[model samples]
Target: MPARTQLSALRTFRPSKRLKVSAVALTAAGATTALALAGTATQSTSALPAIDVAKVTAGSQAGTKVEGLTQGVADKAYPAYVGKPTAAAAKNTSRDLTKAPAKAKPAAAAEHKAKPAANRSTVRKPVAVSAPKYADNLDGWIRESLAIMKAKGIPGSYSGLHRNIIRESSGNPNAVNDWDINAINGIPSKGLLQVIQPTFDTYHVAGTANHLTDPVANITAAANYAAHRYGSIDNVNSAY
Candidate 1:
């Protein structure tokens, strides 16, 4: 073969290095584009909705913790999935419980507490105090004797008692007449209103001392005798 014909045949059989590299690069680029398109189609089918970057950044800056962002995102996108008035209902229940004490306080206080200040004046007061029935003195003795006498229908006076007591024993309650005719007869006249023991015993008034020498007992016995024999002690002017 001629030299030029041989050279052309070699060129046809083997390509240049630069052309080979260029061809391989073009094939690689085409394959990369096809793979990118396939990835884009997959992303479009299952991609999450876009987040508000500004809000996320602001929340991050304000140090707010993010939780359940996917669910929160859905709730924010659809208004019908929002919460109900449960918080408001709970608040109303709390308010009703707080007012329950106020409603119940009046009834409980009316049953157990003291009377109100407005009604205090209408309450009945206690009865007035009266004097005691018994006293331990001479005046007390006379008053008690008079009370008993009045009960038994025995008539006498304070002046008459004073006169008789003075005349009989000069107001000496313990005086006794041992030398008198009654004493000689074995019965002594004794006490302020002097009378023999027998006479005192015979005319002894109830609710008085049994001892004849007792002043009140003696007076009471003598008065009782006078009441029966002479109608009253006031009628006894002298020794009976």
Candidate 2:
């Protein structure tokens, strides 16, 4: 390998203009070119395009004779040098907001005020729950899905919907490849249980792109997919 990088080597290179002198100035630059060819050299005003300059540099920097050498740069090893590193990328400004936001919430305040034994109420909201559709494990799937739905801004409850994802991916975070009936073109399904690439792309939310592999994006996309296919995940436990 010849110093490969993510970008092409030629595109990054820029030849120094140290030799931009006229033919007359070059002759005056003189003895620097002496002890070699005696041929007179003339200058042309037309500047070669970058690609042309690169090609010429690619040739000459190899120590090939401009007049008749056939050696290409690839024939020899060229010692590589690296410039000093530029300033480090500014420190990421990401903040841990979970704690302060929780403390500031009205629900937290209400909970604190109602903690006294006399103020506690025996009445509880009727929480509707359902069984998992997929038959196996059910732990963590609903809570994760609820968090996903909120992150996506999708308004719905995991109430009767947990069964849907339980059926789709069984809570495997990076699941792909569906050997069952879902495998297409031989690659397994992927992310937050399983979602085929095309379907994910079709249902992906605006801010959540690359849903096929990104967990959050996939979760959001899966929620949207379920909502789009069935009236809700509660109806058809399709993709999840």
Candidate 3:
């Protein structure tokens, strides 16, 4: 061949088998590098310690337990967070409600029993009072006159007879009203009760003395005359 044709052939000449061998070697090198890196990562992860989840939960057997926590911390914190009352306090309140009430006296009875005596405004005397007394001589004459007047169905008291005798005779047994109206009519009054002759004879008690100056006889006759004129000698306070 000429020199120029030989140079062209050399430029176009390819080593096909050697090229295939180099490509195959490069693929094998890359595959070997990837496998080495994967083995190194797996061995490093397996060398660390393992964790047991069951043993951590088994420490708390009574109440619920959180992960990585003990029972002591949960027991102390449960009461502070939950403020509801317990069963024992509710039972004590129920016992107190079941007890009986105490007995007591009424307010009106206490007030009535404790009232003071000074508060009573209408108190009164418990016994009756008696009339006044007179002298012995005058008392005897008046009492005797009252007895005779009573027998004749006439009404008179010792107090009434004594009062009239004091006004008429001034307690004199032989008193005479000679200057008064009875004397002006020619009939005068005499004795303790001061009876005139006509009045003495007209109203004389049957069993008594028959003189105007006799004390008991004069008193009885005068009371009888007074009873005939007025209602009774007790009703007469002035001269008849």
The TM-score leader among the candidates is 1
Clashes of each: 0, 4, 0
Candidate 1 residues 108-145, lDDT tens each?
A: 87876665566656968889998558565556666777
lDDT of 2 by residue, 221-240 (tens): 76777777665555664443
lDDT of 2: 0.52
What TM value does model 1 have?
0.46
Q: How many angstroms is residue 164 displaced in model 1 relative to the true structure, after the best TM-score fit?
A: 2.5
lDDT of each: 0.69, 0.52, 0.70
Order the candidates by TM-score, highest first — what do you get?
Answer: 1, 3, 2
Residue 15 CA error for candidate 3 (Å)? 99
Identify the superior model by TM-score, candidate 1 or candidate 3: 1
- Name the Cα RMSD for model 3: 25.9
Name the regions of candidate 3 deviating beyond 4 angstroms.
1-136
**Model 2 / residue 157 / CA error / Å:** 1.6
The TM-score that candidate 3 achieves is 0.42
